[model samples]
Target: MTERKPRKDAVRNREAVLAAADVLFTRCESPADVTMADIATAAGVGKGTLFRAFGDRTGLIRALYAARLEPVREAIEEGPPPLGPATPPLERVPALLDAVLCFKLDNRHLALALEGNGSDSPYRAEHYERWHTLLHDMLERIPGLTDSAFTAHALLAAVRADLVEHLAGHEGLPREEMRGHLASFAAALLGTRPRGG
Candidate 1:
């Protein structure tokens, strides 16, 4: 028995839907404002096609978010330091957190939508687990750093989308300043810098 491939039209429609949805999400103030019907209309497809291409709104959002994150994931997974695996744990840990912060900053609205979608805890997200595990392992490599697991969670929480949005969007903190603050905070924990320096 041979596996059947998706029809050409189906492939085309799926691409159109994803492209349309990406544009809609990028322009919308809130993810909730971009409905499946809106995406279907924008993509020039029927509602049924939209649902068929992506199971539901959450599924679509997750897909879009994952697509946007692909480059960052690749850099972290294989590209050069300090995000790549070859970097020392001490240097890589802060770089990892910084990269995460910048990603949230760049994708503020989408990050907020996905993490605050209310379907479930952001902690349950696969990306969250990947990041947490990476950070945990890095933290464990630091000498005298007990509670690496809890420390990793704490570090990640500090950069949570909502908190970042609050600080950057609401409180009006500058991006570089926020990054500096996070780097300094992490440095203290790693004992690489003086506290509050």
Candidate 2:
């Protein structure tokens, strides 16, 4: 038996909706400002179609966030060193956290929406699990890193969207400065930093 493919119109509609949502989310001051109705109007699709395609606002946000993260995920999964599988645990651990921090920083609005939209705990999100597992696995490979599970959670917590937003938006921290701080923190945990000058 052959697998079923989405109809051409469904594919077109999905692309249109995603494109419209990307623009709306990027342009709006807050993700809350971009509603399903607004997205439907922007995409020239009926509200029912939007609901059918994405289930609801939370689902749509998850889909959009996943789409935005595809490149980063691909890099970690298949690209070159510091993030790829071939990199040493000491190097890759910090690089993975850096990638996550940069992703949250770059997609602040989307990340904020997906994490703060009141659907459920951000801990329960699929992406969170993926990051946690990847970090945990990397930390396990590092010598002297005994609590890989807890350490993974701790490191990821530092880059959580809410915390990143607090530092970036509320505290007015610079992006590079925040990245540096996170890198230093991760280095300390992994015992990968060189001795003082």
Candidate 3:
């Protein structure tokens, strides 16, 4: 059977809720500071609507994050070289890491909301597994690289949401500087010269 589409009102409500939650997450000092009730209030929707649409707080955050991450996913999966599959592994690996770092930097609040939910380890999240698997596969393709799994995990650790917040928020590292550092780190790991160096 064909899948049924949601009602127009349902679609509108979901967008409103997501927008409201985005604002709340962006402004709050901590993800825990923004609650479902706050989101419902900001969206002008009832609590039941949110629960029905998202299941729980974690569900809502994941949905929001996935929505925000769609472009990155598309680029990596099918777009042109560097991020796309057509690029060589050595180039693509650092490009992939750069993309992830940029995304986390751009969506620091939302990222923290999803990764710092405290209900479960972020490593177990579907998104994390996808990234790990992608990175592992790419790392394996690069000659002289060993322990692709551990290496992927280690590289990803540099861009973790908490660490991003600590660097960008607390340490006040400039965004370009952070990206530069990450690029250098990736280059060192891949036995490459840092970009523009």
Most lDDT-accurate candidate? 3
Stretches of candidate 3 off by over 4 Å are: none
Model 2 residue 75 lDDT score: 91
Specify the poorest-scoring 10-residue window by lDDT in model 3.
188-197
Worst 10 residues of 2 by lDDT: 188-197
lDDT of each: 0.87, 0.89, 0.94
Taking all chains together, each candidate's TM-score versus the true structure is 0.91, 0.95, 0.97
Task: Give lDDT tens digits, candidate 2, residues 32-143.
Answer: 8999999999999999999999999999989999999999999999999978999998888888888999999998988899989887888888999999999898888887
**Residue-pair clash count for candidate 1:** 0
For residues 21-86, what per-residue lDDT tens digits would candidate 3 score against the true structure? 989988898888999999999999999999999999999999999998999999999999989999
Question: Model 3 compared with the native: what TM-score?
Answer: 0.97
C-alpha lDDT of residue 156 in model 1: 94
Ranking 2 against 3 by TM-score, winner: 3
* Cα lDDT of model 1 by residue, 1-197, tens digit: 99999999999998888789888877887767888899899999999987777788888778888988898899999989989999989889888899999999988877887888898889989889999999998888878899999899989998999999899989999999999999998887787862245
Q: If the candidates were sorted by their TM-score against the true structure, best first, what order would they fall in?
A: 3, 2, 1
Query: Which residue pairs of candidate 3 clash?
Result: none
Clashes of each: 0, 0, 0
With candidate 1 superimposed using the best TM-score fit, by how many Å does residue 44's alpha carbon deviate from the native?
Answer: 1.8
Question: lDDT of model 3 at residue 152?
Answer: 96
